[model samples]
Target: MRALSYFFVIFAIFLAPLGVAVARHLADDTQATDWRTARRDSTGIAPLPAQTPEAVIHVYAARAFRWRGAFGVHTWIAAKPQGADAYTRFEVVGWGVSQGRNAVRVGEGVPDGYWYGNAPTLIRALRGGDEVDALIERLRAAATAYPHQHEYRVWPGPNSNTFIAYLGRAVPELHLDLPPTAIGKDYLPDTGVFARAPSGGGFQVSLAGLLGVTLAAEEGLEINLLGLSLGLDLSPPALKLPGVGRIGMSEE
Candidate 1:
């Protein structure tokens, strides 16, 4: 009886938000477009490399393609070296992975390109001289050393979110605070069950990213179940829902 009650409580706390997320997704027309026809144009959110002489690093997250957007988001990192004429974008893409291509893609493209049709939200931005340049170098090295370069899993394991999460741990100074909708963000590779949160300001324990709890100054308190996260952010007095994301304050 006690076990049954506990299960119900957990279900209500986590699953309820997921249900709301589903409803919200269904009602949003922005996700109804087909992938092939979806807009991939830049949203003009990134600094133009030719016009900006300072080194810059940006983290972006957009709703996942198609139905997956209802559950989670896709994240990536973009950087520009001081005086560079182009931005190099780094992200794990599962599209050609089945064809034996590497999952980790590093190339030049629009720094703020849309994810399919969804406009990306800027998660973090840093601009400076030598310090930002050094951070970008570290980020590049971390991307090269990512363990699951040949693997891709859309849920509960090594995926795009997982890749960004790895970078966060590798370069804590980024202080990446991945939102709750980053489904695979909690997936720690061989790093064991307990590790620093993606934000580097907190710690989290996970069971293969399916179940976990995170506590941090930046991330607040998050409960991860079956790859969905629910939590409360006391600093901004926000509620972090599974699909709807943080609801109380503007991230900016």
Candidate 2:
């Protein structure tokens, strides 16, 4: 009886936020459209490359398509080199991996475009001159070096979040603080239970992205269980819940 009670407590602690996430997802009217015909238009969030004429980098996250939005988000990166006419977008997608297609996609799209029908939230941005341009070059190299280019797993894996996490580690200058709703961000390929946090602010230990603890200057403290994260942020004070994401202070 004691063990059963303990299990129930643990389940509630981890799953309560997921329940809230489901409720919120159901209440969102934006998901009503079918994916094939869903809106992928730009939100006019990123600056126009031609007008800016300087190096720029952006990281964006949006709720995943369909029911997955109730659990986590999909993340991607975009950059424009100094004086470049267009922006380059980088992301890992699982669209055709089963048939031997590469999961990493490097293509041109609206830098801040919607994912399917979901409007994206900007996670980070860096705009500058030569320094930012240098970072963009390194970011391109990191995307090419991602080890899981041909592999993908929707849960606890080397999926889209994992790809962004890799880029964060590879280019620590980004200082990315991925939201807890990024289900696969804890996955560390070849690192084996220990690695630098995705933000490069501290360190973390994760077991196949299933279970872990993160202690970071930027991320605060996070606990990962079964691909769901729960934690607290001290700087601006926030509660990080599994699917509901951070509640309290806004990210800097």
Candidate 3:
């Protein structure tokens, strides 16, 4: 018991600083990301990107559970270019079986599940009138400067590197979490792009079990039935983008 307590203390001390640094870094990078005024193209469809050559999408989801098989809300995200055929997908699936119910699994078949950058954050910033190219550049610069921080890694790694992170140097808005923790491992994609799950249980039992216990401790584990899937199509940029706009936000 004493040893475990010591381990946690040390873990928090070391992890807290690292988490804060990552969070701050992400915040700075996100602030520098460009936000574009997405418009309906000639086809009346607003594709993912309007000016960039390659576009990306982002998806994320998480759930918690309790002993009797209670679960938390499932979440997801989709980020795609202004005009494209298929969007990347991310999902969260439960893995354990209870009362004949299946286990919990997450981050599959949702858009941009492979992308590290936050699509909603980027899009919101763009809608708020940030420059897209500059955002990309800042993200790229951050990517280059940091090269280690990722959405899902115990330490610095590209395990979570996704196509979204490769967006021609455009940075995405950092979803706010002051002290960022390592993104859980499974959601971490293997490469620049994400592929659909071939088969098998989605969430590994260890992580799922940990998450279930943690959430159950907090919220008493409520059973939730949340099913979400997003489909996106990007055609092509109808409007030309202006020279990189100046992001006026003050940096910390």
Candidate 4:
């Protein structure tokens, strides 16, 4: 009996560390996976080829500008399987000034972590099919789940670009300071040609404006039947300015 008791005590002592090790491991995992601190995306958008979806449901975007130089860009896309009608909206908004030097850059360049630190849902919906309704519901859920305020980088000079992304919300009125006459509605012949300007002057295509509003109200960044083509050149674009030799950088 004495020997058995001694053996039992030894075994219990040996097992205690193993149990403690397991508990510590579980705690570490939980902390690493929590979104409040370090979030991760299981459904983020992939690279260009990864975005080539088979079909889509509904998409929208918009941009608003105030004469003083404040402007806003919004984009949203609702997508799902073929039989669904509801749509998901991803939206973003930016309101500030850039003394004409550069454009404000919103959201980080990482494709997966942009949506309030969550994965972008557009790619997932496209994979599902042409069901708009389902897509919208998913987007609504994501938007509801988004954290309220976040900071993004912007431009310093006049010739810069700003980009923003949305998670979910209804499209809002594009309040522009320019009179209807100043804001000419130059609809492009081919929907493909949504918006185009000489890189510096003001720009607003019906498609870009509409999509900006949609995204401002919804959850996705890329939307519409036509889709999205976003390019951020770290290297300056090919522009020949009298004073500024040739702006140059890289592309994201």
Best by lDDT: 2
lDDT-best of 2 and 4: 2
Q: Give residue 142's error in model 2 in angstroms.
A: 1.2
Better of 1 and 4 by lDDT: 1
113-182 per-residue lDDT for model 3 (tens digits): 2122222212222321234333434543444443223232212222222222222112324321100121
How well does model 4 score by local distance difference test?
A: 0.29
C-alpha lDDT of all candidate models, in order: 0.90, 0.91, 0.26, 0.29
Clashes of each: 0, 0, 46, 68
Single out the weakest 10-residue window by summed lDDT for candidate 3. Answer: 224-233
The reply for model 2, stretches above 4 Å from the true place, is 1-7
Alpha-carbon TM-score of each model against the true structure: 0.96, 0.96, 0.24, 0.23
Model 2 reaches what TM-score against the true structure?
A: 0.96
Q: Model 4, range 119-215, lDDT digits (tens) per residue?
A: 3333122344434435445545544443322322322111111121222112111111111111111222223233322121233344522232111
RMSD of each: 1.3, 1.4, 18.4, 24.9
lDDT of 4 at 48: 32
Q: Report the Cα lDDT for residue 80, model 1.
A: 96
Alpha carbon lDDT of residue 236, candidate 4?
A: 30
lDDT value for model 2: 0.91
